[model samples]
Target: MTRYLEGQTAIVTGGMRGIGLGIARRLHSAGAQIVIWDLAVDGWDSVANGFEPVMRQAVNVASLASVEAGFKEVVAQQGRVDILVNNAGINGPVTPCWEYPPAAWDQVIAIDLTGVFYCCRTVIPHMRERGYGRIVNVASMAGKDGVQYISGYSAAKAGVIAFTKAAAKELAQDGVLLNCIAPAMVETGLMAEMTPEHIAASKAKIPMGRFLQIEEIANMVTWIAGPECSFTTGFVFDLSGGRATY
Candidate 1:
């Protein structure tokens, strides 16, 4: 059987756990070499099984220096990066916009929005040089609908979606495709931070009346990361389970 992603190298930020882990597993199953860039180094060993000898890098996505150093190491080890999944993010504090903390806001923006930019900015040149690349940024439905009490997270994810569009246009002619996925609530560690009331409210909003499974998101990402996804750059793929109106 010919693997769809054989011989490709992929970098998945926050790949140590949760949705990112699911993505890494799927891509690896498709035969891509996995490099997980995350702050949690200990979990890599468990997730590394069955992948093509996964590379683990302890990276703080919020810092450009950290991202640069991590990517440099990735290049040193793998020699190339064919796909990038910008999946690192934090929900910050769940509070009204007026009550949101400045520090918390900055933290969310740094990790969820600016971090994606940093990864793209660092890897895009390499992708352009190679004349091939697939970049997937993970945004959220909150970005589109502006969920109440999570202003910081919503705004940051919105920025990610916007950035994906702008960057995709800039690189459209360069053979490097960039797109983002806006998913509704998923059952991940991030949900642990939300109050039960908040979780229930989010579920009620989804027409499907359920949280998305990680594998569903992974399957969508797998397709988007493959060659068959050609000609679909600069767009947002909705994974909202009927919650997204646009």
Candidate 2:
């Protein structure tokens, strides 16, 4: 409503749906032009059509080549990217560490953690040259508290949290603030990947006794992606609804 981000452009990875779509809509509402990078899985066109003039880029965040090419296309069209929300990720199979398939673990790490690295590695330089930027990564509270039966997901997200801190320090003086949000379970399609028991267990851990709304995560991310969040970098903001105090 404030239009604080007016005249800026933002790229939201995996922005076709779920948490990524929520953040893209929020940034658009704040007056930033939206560029959605997604693999454009089935039924994606209908979702893309619902948005107001969103620039859609078919992208697979897990691949560095795809990420690089996507970044180039965005710059070519938008001129510059003022905000980047690295929200693309997948929750690997819900299984114990011992039972977790090695390939599943690698896949999760590639997309959830390594994808962030690829995006940051590609964009930081461009942002640094511009002398200003805001990047918010969507992490998870599971990374900190370590939820059972989701070892791959937990480890990948933990890596994301740590990655944010380390990158933020390097850009502290460069006017490029990097931060991440560690949210508890949210009411997103991502839950479809988990079993009912796992979902219930996650919700029960929240003191609020409820899952997070997509708009709530969007609200926090919008603020962090704005100029007002100038003082903090390399920090993890909590959106766990009292499940994680740290």
Candidate 3:
């Protein structure tokens, strides 16, 4: 039939690097036009050219106006967004509950959890109106398994999963599907921010004995965002390399 994403448009937050960038590349390969909203700006990355009219906007996900204005800009430039990938997120310091910084905790919640909320709240209406749209949210295995050192990040991602389920139920009747993916530890520069010991500990838990590749997660996102993703809403797809059971 029609090449799945032919003539379709997409918005990928944090699409400049890592898993988000990978998803942008995947969707582009499938024939979708893309607009990237992210804070990272490096001129050398080849993937930046993958998206047509790739607009580079540095945004703090916590700000409502930024979300609103950004989506508005996407629509203004691209006409309508057929797919929305909520992938911009963060992991605060790996500290015990008592040691967690209040400000840092807020930052994590804002970027990881509330960022998804802001995007969903604004973009879902367009999908609901179009009666044909797909939204893929990128959560983490920690959202399901709750790692020991990142209580705040875990709690925020847990909210993301719950929100995905609830929103899926509400939007399914409108022909809009929403799904969440939980990846364990994907190999990306993000890991560089973590301590060596922490990364080693995370790798030790995965039965696969190594970190996940960014492209692996991107494949899942593309599958879920495509036209055939019908009949599956509010479901969480696991990509933790067998680290999760639920």
Tell me which of candidates 1 and 3 scores higher on TM-score. Answer: 1
Please give the CA lDDT of all the candidate structures: 0.91, 0.90, 0.86
TM-score leader: 1
**lDDT (Cα, tens digit) per residue for candidate 3, span 27-53:** 988888877888755573553455443
lDDT of 2 by residue, 56-149 (tens): 8888888889989989988888899999999999998998899999999999999999999999999999999999999999999988988899
In the order shown, the candidates' Cα RMSDs to the true structure are 1.4, 1.6, 1.9
Off by over 4 Å in 3: 40-53
Better of 1 and 2 by TM-score: 1
Please, what are the lDDT tens digits per residue for candidate 1 over residues 113-196?
999999999999999999999999999999988999999999999999999999999999999999999999999999878899
TM-score per model over all chains = 0.96, 0.96, 0.94
Q: Indicate the residue-level lDDT of 60 in model 2.
A: 85
- As a whole number from 0 to 100, the lDDT of residue 82 in candidate 1 is 97
Q: Which run of 10 residues does model 3 get worst, by summed lDDT?
A: 44-53
lDDT of 1 at 149: 97
By lDDT, the best candidate is 1
